[model samples]
Target: MKPVLWMKSSCTTCRNAKAKLAELGLEVEVRDYFKKPLEAGELEHLLPADPAPMLGTKSPKYKELGLKDRHLSKAEAISLMVQDNNLLKRPILVHPKGTVIGFDAEAYARLVR
Candidate 1:
């Protein structure tokens, strides 16, 4: 499968990630998650057993729920993220090799190389 970039179009970080991918000459299918959020089953398929890496700790809802101090099961985390797309980290590259959350210049470059 081709690499799919899951992100929120309104987010600056997501936009920068997209630009970085372009700069790397890596074409990907963009999924504006906010516009078309994924279902729990879909997220389960994409994410590993521990979905913590995919959680958006910086999101207001995460803070509102005090998730930082709380320990959540994989099911709980996916539930929250599915309920609020904002709860999911932006610019997740669902590549053939694996999934990557947030923008990492080196990791993104490695996808194509």
Candidate 2:
């Protein structure tokens, strides 16, 4: 299957990730999560059991929600992400090899290799 990339178009990191993928000759299916928010079931399927890795800690929305202070459960995190897509970290790459939460050139290379 072609690798799927979940990213925000406005994020520079996400843009860089796309360029890197293209440089690697990877034709990826890009999912602009900001435009089309992810469903709870979709996030559950794409994310690991612990969804913290997928959470965007630096997101303004995250701070607005005061998630840093609270100890949230896996379910709670997922619920919050569903409620607000901004809570999710961008450029999540899903491939047959594995799922990568951020843009790592080496990881991207290994994933498609």
Candidate 3:
């Protein structure tokens, strides 16, 4: 099982989620969301399906940019994400079957176990 967790180095939530994963004795590969962010093509490769409306950040900047309010085409959204990695929701756990976004404890436990 490829347990790759994508995270912004500064996000406390991302740090906490990583610690939990480690506590479970799961050795996960880490992706630096800011330095080496995931691209749309990368999402398609790692995720089960193309994350269209699904890919986004709940961070203030993205919200300030009104990404959620966007009626963007798939390509448009992907382009924006490429330009700004913070556009991706943090601690996105890319598993073999699917993905976990935003560091949800209950959901992550279900998948990790």
Candidate 4:
């Protein structure tokens, strides 16, 4: 199966990831998650069993939304992400081998190769 890249157009990391994929000559289906939000099932598949990986803990909105004090289950975290695309990390790359969250050049290279 072709790789799928879930990203936001305005994010620099996402842009870089997209460029890297292109540079590697790998075909990808790009999904701007903000424009076309992910479904709960999709998020479940993309995220790890732990909520921390998918949850954007560094996002300002995370604090603004008062999520810092709360302990969310995996389902809850996915629900929140579905409601606010900003709550999810950027440039999630999904391949047949595995998935990569966020921008890591080394990881991308391994996946692309």
Candidate 5:
């Protein structure tokens, strides 16, 4: 299967990831999570069970929503992310070998190459 890149169009990291994939001559399927939000199952598959990695702690929305103080379970976090794609960290690259969350140039190179 072709690697799938879950990303937002406006994110610089997402753009960089896409460019790097191209540079490596790897064909990828891009999924704009903003336009098409991820389902719960998809989120569960992409994210860690801990939910901390899936949650975008740095997002203003997280602060605005006052989620920092709240301890959300895996299900709650997954549900929240499904409702709001912005709650997720951008540029999740899914490959046959493994999945990489966020932008890691070295990881991308290792997986894509």
Candidate 6:
């Protein structure tokens, strides 16, 4: 199966994930998720759960966009992420039906082996 990794160069998390994958000898195709927002269908599968707690900038956007006070449905979150890729969590690793966020070692281990 092919490995699809949505990556942003400047993100340390993405770089770490890439390094881990490389250490495990897993080849991945990294795409710039910032420049290209994912489709709703794609983003939907990658997101964690409802409310998307992990999704959103720790930066001022979280407060500025009022995401802290807002509650969004799955579809709403998907739409928002498509409109702004930054809304999606970093280093999303895709493999078949599974999508792992933040380059988690345990999760990526499943993909690695």
The prediction achieving the highest TM-score against the true structure is 1
Residues 1-113, candidate 2: write the lDDT tens digits.
98898999999999999999999998999999999999988987877777777789988989998877777777888898988888888889888778888889999988667
What are the per-residue Cα lDDT tens digits for candidate 6 across 7-82? 8888998999989888888788888877775787776666667846557556455566788778878888787777
Give the distance in Å from residue 3's predicted Cα in candidate 3 to where it truly belongs: 1.1
- After TM-score superposition, the amount by which residue 99's alpha carbon in candidate 6 deviates from its true location, in angstroms, is 2.0
User: What is the overall TM-score of model 5 with all chains considered together?
Assistant: 0.89
Off by over 4 Å in 3: 46-57
Q: Which candidate, 2 or 3, would have the higher TM-score against the true structure?
A: 2
Cα RMSD (Å) per model? 1.0, 1.3, 2.5, 1.5, 1.6, 2.3
> What C-alpha lDDT do the candidate models reach, one value each?
0.87, 0.87, 0.73, 0.86, 0.86, 0.76
Which of 1 and 2 is ahead in TM-score? 1
Off by over 4 Å in 6: 48-54, 57-59
Model 4, residue pairs in steric clash: none
Ranking 3 against 4 by TM-score, winner? 4
- Which runs of model 5 end up more than 4 angstroms from their true locations? none
Output the better candidate (2/4) by lDDT: 2
Error of 4 at 45 (Å): 1.7
Q: How close is candidate 1 to the true structure, as a TM-score?
A: 0.94
Range of the 10 consecutive residues with the lowest summed lDDT in candidate 4: 48-57
**Deviation in angstroms for 72 in model 2?**
2.2
Q: Model 5 over residues 1-113: C-alpha lDDT tens digits? A: 98999999999989998998888887899999888889999887777777777678778878988998887888988888887888998888889988888888789789755
Worst 10 residues of 6 by lDDT: 51-60
lDDT of 4 by residue, 44-80 (tens): 8787777776667778889898887887788988888
Q: Report clash pairs, candidate 3.
A: none
Q: Give the TM-score of candidate 2.
A: 0.91
Each prediction's number of clashing residue pairs: 0, 0, 0, 0, 0, 0
| Lowest-sum lDDT 10-residue window in model 3 | 44-53
Task: Write the residue-wise lDDT of candidate 1 on 1-113 in tens digits.
Answer: 87899998999999999999999998899999789989998888877787778888899999999998887888998888888989888889988877788989889888888
